[model samples]
Target chain A: MHELSIALSIVEGAGEEAARRGGKVSVVHLRLGQLSGVVKDALLFSYDLACEGTLLEGSRLMIEEEPVVVFCPECAAERALASIQSFRCPVCGALTPDVVRGRELELVALELTYEQHAASATPATTD
Target chain B: MNNTPHPPRLPRLIEVRKNVLKRNDLLARKLRDRFRAASVFVASLVSSPGAGKTAFLEKTLTALRAQCRVAALVGDLATDNDAARLARAEVPVRQITTGTVCHLEAEMVERALDGWNLDELDCLFIENVGNLVCPSSYDLGEEMRLVLMSVTEGEDKPLKYPTIFNTADVAIITKIDLAAAVEFDLKSARRNIQSVRPGMRVFELSAKTGEGMDEWLRLLQSRL
Candidate 1:
C-alpha cells in the first residue's frame, strides 16, 4: 500500500515540526479525505513502522476523515456524497465531476509535551 | 528527601496545517521545472495489471523514435521484463524495480534519470507500475498522464475506480482488436468514462494490430 510512504512522510514532517517547536510530540492530528485514495486503517497500521526510533515514536495518530462534496451543475448546489466512489448528484441524479473536497491529506495539528507549561504558555499571560 | 507537590505536564496543541504529500509535490514540481527547461515532452502511462501498458508503450516508442530522440523509464514491483520489452524498440530504457511499493513516486522517476541527459531526448515516457488504485495519488511530473483500460476489463472500470479516471489526462482503451472476442461494450465504456469525467479525451487502439494507432500517434505528435 502507498499508505506506508504516506505514513513515513507524515512522521518525518511531524518530526521537523516538533524539533522546530522545541518539544516532544505526543499526538499527531491528521485530516484524511474520503477521496484522498489513502486507506486510514492501512496508514494507522504502518504508522508504527514509520515512527520507529524517531521523534514520533510511540506518538498517537489521530485521523479526522473528511466527507466528499461535489458541486452539481444542474442543481446549482453542492452535494455531500454518501458513497465516495460515485459522483452522482444526490438531488439532481446527474454526475458531477467537480470535486470541492474529500481529497485532503493534511497534518492539521501536533500535540506536544513541554518541561514547564507556564514558561511555554504565551497566550495565557495577563498584565 | 523533601516531599513537594508538582503539577503534571500537559501536552499543548500546535497548529501545522501542512499537506502530508507536500514533500512529494514539491519534488514533482521541481521535476516539472526541469523537464520544461530541457524542452522534453513527457508522457506517463498507468493501468491495472495486464492492461497492455508495455505493449502500447513499445509501439509508441518505436513509432516516435523514428523522427525524434526517445527514452523510457518503466516501473514494476519485481521484474525488469517490462524494461526489456520496451528495449526491443531500440531506445534508451531503464527499469525501476520498486521492491514492495505498489506505485512509483516522483523521487523514483527523478533518480532513474541520473545518467540520462534530458536535453538530448525530445520525448520521455514513464510507464508506471501496474496498479490503478495507488498510482492515482502520485504525480510523476509528466506533462500528460494516460490511463489505459483493456477491452477485457469490462465497461464499468471507470465507475469502480473513479479516482484514477479523475486524475488521468486521457483514457486509452487498449486491445480493441479483441473487443468482439471479449464481448466488450464500447458504448458502455465510453458512457462510463463520460460519467466519471465529462468531456475527457479518450482514444481506443490495439497495439498488436496497429488499429487506430495512427490517431493515437497523431495525438502524441501534436503534444510534442
Candidate 2:
C-alpha cells in the first residue's frame, strides 16, 4: 500500500518538526480513515523501520481508526458501514445517499515536549 | 501528553501524533508551482500489471514528442522492461526500479530528475507501479491523475475500486483494439465510470492500432 511511502514522509517531516521544536519526537499520531485508502497495519509495520536512525527513531505510532459512516435516505438514519464496498444499510437495507465522514488525509498537529524554558524569549517592546 | 490513559496498554501512549504525509504534500505543492511557472503540465498513470501501460506510453511518446518536448519515468518492482520498451520510441526515459516497494513516492521522482533538465520538457509522464490500490494514495506532483483500466479487465473496475477513480482526474481505457476479442461491453464500461466519478472525462484508445489516440492527445494538448 502507499502507507509505507506516506509513513516514510511522516518520519522525515516528524524529524524536521522535532528539530524545529528543539526536542525529539516521542510519538506520531495519524488520522487514518476507512476511506483514506490507507492500510493501517501496513503503515504501522513500516513506521518503526522508516523512523530508524531518524529524529523520530523512538516515536510511537498512534492511529484514530475511523468508521465508515454514510447517510441513508430511505430509513433517514446515519449508519455505520462495515466495509468500504458496503453501501446498503443493515437496518433497512436502504442504499446510502452519501458519505458524511471517513475520507480524509490530513496532518492536524504535532505534539512536542513543550519545554517551559523554550517559551522564554527576550522581550522587545516600548511601553 | 505523559499523564495517563483511562485504560492503558504497554504500547506506550507517546503523543508523537504528527502528520507523516506533510512533506509529500509540501513537495507536491512545490512541484506544482514549478510546473505552473514553466507551463509544463504533468500527469501520472496507474493501472494493474500487464495492462499495456508501457505500450500506451510508447504510443503517446511517439505521437507527442514530435510536437512537444516529452519525457517519462517508469516505475516497477523489478527490471527495466518498461524503460526499454519506451526507449525504442526514441524519447528520453528513465527507469526507477523500486526494490521491494509496491509504489512510487514523490521523493523518488525528485531523485530521478537529478541529471535531466526539467525545464527542457513540456510534458512529463510518470507511470507508477502497476497497482490500482496503492498508487491512488500518493501524489506525484502531477497536474493530472490518469487511472487506467484495460478492456480485458472487467467493466466494473470503477465500481470495484472507486477510490482510485475518485482520486484520479481522468480514467483511461486501454487496449480498445482487443475489445471485440474480449467481448468488452463499452456501454457498460462508460456507465460504470460515470457512476464512480460523475461527469469525469474518459479516453478509450488502443496503443497498438493507434485507435482513438488523437482524441486522447488532443485532451492532453488542451490541458497544456
Candidate 3:
C-alpha cells in the first residue's frame, strides 16, 4: 500500500537526474531487499502509475531483489538467512542481531537515451 | 520525398547508486543530531490499531512527567482522539493528522516538532500511525523504537509481521491484564519475538491495570 509513495519517490529521484543529464529515461534500476519491507510486484505496479505523466513515462523498472544477510557471532562471518522469519545463522544456528545487509531500498542506476546530433561533436554528458 | 535523415539514438547507462529514502534518512539524521544536542531521549511506538498504544503512552506520559519533562506527538489518519487522551496527562502533546497516508514520515515528525524547544524536554515520544506494515519502512529519528502487540492480537504476530519486529529495538506485549481472559500464551509470544529478533528487549505490561508497568517505566527512565 505504501509502494505508491515509494514509487513516487523513485520517479522524483530519477526525474531529477534525467533532467540534469538532459536525456529521456529508458530504465530505472532499483535494489530491493527482503528486510526493506517493500513488495516488488506492488512497487512495479505503482511505478507505472507514478510515471504516467513524469519524465520516466514509458521507462521500465528493473528490480534486483536482495536476500537478508546477517553477521553470525559464532561463525564470525556474514551469512544469508534461509528464512526471514528467523535471523539465526544457517550454518551454526547462532542468532545474530547484526544485520550486514538486506534493508536496502536503493536506486542503483538509470538508462537514458539521447538522440545523436551530428552538429555537436561531444557525446552525452554523464556523471 | 526528400527529407533529412534522423540521427540514431543511444541508451546510456549511468550509475546513480542512491537510497530511495535518502531524503527522509537525511532529515531523520538531522533530527537525531538535534535530539542528541538537546539531551532529549526520543522513542517511537508502532503497532496495529487498538493495540493500546495511546493508552500505554498516556500512562507513560503521566508517570514520566513527574520525574522529568515529557511530551508526545501522535499520528493518525483522521481523529485527534489519541492526542486528546494523552493531553489529560497534562504534558505537552501534538497530533499529526495524516489524511490517507498509512505511515508517518520523518518530514511529518520534523514539521510537528516546529516551535517546540527540545531543550526544555527530557523525553519525547512519537506514536506512529497504527500500522504494523507501513511504519516499519520509516524511521522517525528516535533513539529507540518499541513495537507493541496486545496479548489479544495473537502470539504469532512477530512471525506474521517479522519486518516490523526486525526494525524495532524492543517488543512490548500490551494488555497483559487480559491475558488470562483471552487465553494468551505468554511463553509462545516471547518465543516468537525472540525467533524473529534475537536479543531484543521485551516488556510485558498492561496500561490499564498498572501490571508490569514499573519495569517498563524503569527502562524508560534509564534511557532518559
Name the candidate that leads on lDDT: 3
lDDT per residue as tens, model 1, A1-127: 7998899999999999887777788999999988788889999999999999998898999999999888989999988987755678988788877889988999999998865644344322232
Q: Superposing all C-alpha atoms, what RMSD in Å does each candidate have to the true structure?
A: 3.8, 6.9, 2.9
Which digits, one per residue and each the tens of the lDDT, describe model 1 over residues B100-176? Answer: 99999999999999988889999999999999889988888999999999999999999888878878889999999
| Model 2's TM-score against the true structure | 0.74
Per-model TM-score, in order, reads 0.90, 0.74, 0.95
Model 3, chain B only, scores a TM-score of: 0.96
Interface RMSD of each: 2.9, 8.5, 2.3
Q: Write the residue-wise lDDT of candidate 3 on A7-54 in tens digits.
A: 999999999988887778999999999999899999999999999988
Q: Per-residue error at A48 for model 1, in Å?
A: 2.7
User: How do the residues A1-127 of candidate 2 rate in per-residue lDDT, one tens digit apiece?
Assistant: 6676677777776676556545445667778777777888888898888988876777787777887677778878788877665456768876553777776554445555433333333111112
In model 2, which residue pairs have backbone atoms overlapping below 3 Å? A10-B20, A27-B16, A28-B16, A28-B17, A29-B16, A29-B17, A29-B18
Candidate ranking under lDDT, highest first, comes to 3, 1, 2
What number of clashing residue pairs does each candidate have, in the order they appear?
0, 7, 0
For residue B42, give model 2's deviation from the true position in Å.
Answer: 0.9
Per residue, candidate 3 scores C-alpha lDDT tens digits across B1-224 of 23566467668898999899999999999999999999999999999999999999999999998899999999999999999999999999999999999999999999999999999999999999999999988888999999999999999999999999999999999999999999999999998899889999999999999999999999988888
**Please, what is the whole-model Cα lDDT of each candidate in the order they appear?**
0.90, 0.78, 0.93
